[model samples]
Target: MSGTAEDATDATTKRQRRGNTRQRIQDVALELFAEQGYEKTSLREIAERLDVTKAALYYHFKTKEDILVGLSQDLQRPIDELIEWAGTQPRTLDTKREILRRYSVALADVAPLFRFMQENQAAVRELSVGESFKDRMIRLIDTIKEPDAALTDQVRCTSALFTMHAGMFALRDVEGDPEEKRQAVLEVAIDLVTQAHAGAQSPGKPPKSS
Candidate 1:
């Protein structure tokens, strides 16, 4: 039993070390991709920045695109989980507000990846991860907006998500606490969704005389 326990501990340590190395590679690759255009950044550069041999990097990721795809997959897990959790909840104004709050947290967690995506739009568009992310956004929008909502209300719901994205990028250089800026952005997004939900719940105004 002691020998078995030691073997398990060794395996766990190896797995952790491997995970750390993969994370380091992903971080360095994202930095390089953002500094230079994704098309121009090479695997060798990522390996060099990581202070690892090309072969060592290759053991984890065969190509630059692989590293990018890995990063996208890692960052997307929370958003995907949020969408799943939202599906299980009742559709209500409170639910929508909670969705925005949770999404803001997820976006903060992956801000660097999102910034890279914003700067490298064309390159990201060509990748599979880009398409996957777009699909996730559409699903998230559906969760917040009523199916029969007015066109304007639908726009408000859609805009709520973008507001969060734009807020992060726009406020990065501005002087303020990061969490405060995030809360301010979240407030605006929740307000937009609340307005849309209220509009859907309220009676329509009577037609005006010509």
Candidate 2:
């Protein structure tokens, strides 16, 4: 019984250790890719920086592209899940507003992935991550905008997301705390959603929101 218990403990420890090593590899790889440019960074360099043998690193990721794909896949998983969940819900303004709120939270950590994506557009394209990215954006917009939404209102919803994305990079130079800027951006986005929702509901009503 003691032998069995000891073996289980050792297995658990090994699993935990492996998980930590994988996360560390991801961190170091991203840092290096940012510092040295993805095209120039090699798996050997990554293994060297992590002080691990190339074969050990290869056991986790066979190539630099594999590491990048892993990073993007990790970052995009939540968004893909959110989009899938939203697809099953009834179409309503409330649902759309909630989607925006949830999406804001989902995107909080994705800022870095976006940074890598913008800098490595060609790699992302080559890897075909952009296909799912575009598809998810369409689904998200469908959740928010009315199917019969007027072009202007559609523009508002589209612009709302663009503004939120722009805020991530554009407001980097702005004064005040990052949280404050995030709230301000959220407020603006929520206002856009509210306006679009109102316009869709009110046939002859004045502007729903600006």
Candidate 3:
């Protein structure tokens, strides 16, 4: 199992490196943009920071907008994939829960990229990257939520997903082992999923009297 996982990771790493020079340039460009202001960063500076010639960076990206598009694509492909995969899965509670778990893992893998996006909203908006990302998020939400689900249960499921993200950010401030914090956050998410599922089948049903 470990071998298979490692092989998959290696393959993913290699794939990320190959045919994704544009993506790498975008990643580095976003880093520079975030460090300095987007308005202050130049393509030449990006090249300098990356130790590459301006012409080389220009080969992959004609302009900073091009770089932003590349970065959005890199951050988006997996979520698009997840949305596609989820659309074909059974809409059972188990499937919904699995969707949350898988999403949490995917979010963790791209946390740094997410941070860059959050911090550079104006640039992301300028490049229209935010639109594509938001569209996919809506799709993901639709996948986990049933038609006509009660508002409270929907809130629980939504809160569950956000908690995982918050945990990733918040745990940094809390003093404890990282793994333990993750597990605790995961437990809360799982609990919320369970609560959401309990009411999912009956749109307006309240909890049974004890």
Candidate 4:
């Protein structure tokens, strides 16, 4: 019994090591892709950067596009899960706020992927990045916007989503901490969703004074 248990532990450790190696390969590949254009990066260069043989890299990922697709999937999975979770929740102000808060957290760690996607627009479009993102945005918007909302209220909901997306790139040159800017952007997005929700709930009614 002890031998069996020891073998299982060894297998688990080996699996974890393999997973870490795969992740490292993906990270280095993305870094190289960002430094140079994706079109200019090659599998040999990636292996060189990692100090690994091409055969070793091939044992994990078969191609450069495969690495990219893996990275894209990793980035998309959280938002996909968030959209699924939001779909099952009651569409209330609190839910919208929570969605925005959760989204802000999701976007926070995705800066590298975001920068890579922006620089390699054509490559991103060719992968699952483009449509997957659009679908998630649509799901988020539908969750936040009321079925009977007026045009302006709908715009507010849409704009709130776009604001988070823009904040990542727009404030890159501004003179403030990244976290501070993220908080400011999240506050603005939450405000937009809150106002849109209130407007939809009470049509033609002016906002209550603070």
Candidate number of the best TM-score: 1
**Models ranked on TM-score:** 1, 4, 2, 3
Please give the range of 10 consecutive residues that has the lowest summed lDDT in model 4. 124-133
Models, CA RMSD each: 2.7, 2.6, 7.5, 2.7
Runs off by more than 4 Å, candidate 4: 204-210
List runs of model 1 lying over 4 Å from the truth.
206-210
lDDT, residue 177, candidate 1: 99
Task: Give the Å shift of residue 17 in candidate 2.
Answer: 1.4
* Clash count list over all predictions: 0, 0, 0, 0
- For candidate 3, the per-residue lDDT at 114 reads 71
lDDT of 2 by residue, 122-209 (tens): 7667665666677777767777888877777888898777777777777867898977887788778878877888888875765644
What tens digits encode model 1's per-residue C-alpha lDDT throughout 123-178? 99999888989999999999999998888789999999999999999999999999
Error of 4 at 46 (Å): 0.8
**Each prediction's whole-model lDDT (CA):** 0.90, 0.79, 0.77, 0.87
Pairs of residues clashing in candidate 3: none
* Segments of candidate 2 deviating more than 4 angstroms: 85-90, 203-210
Q: For model 4, which pairs clash? A: none
In candidate 4, residue 55 scores what lDDT? 97
Per-residue CA lDDT of model 3 for 51-161, tens digit only, reads 889988877779887777776675588788888888899988778777777777776677666766766677676667778887777778788777777787788777887
Q: Which residues of candidate 3, in runs, are more than 4 Å off?
A: 1-24, 37-39, 207-210
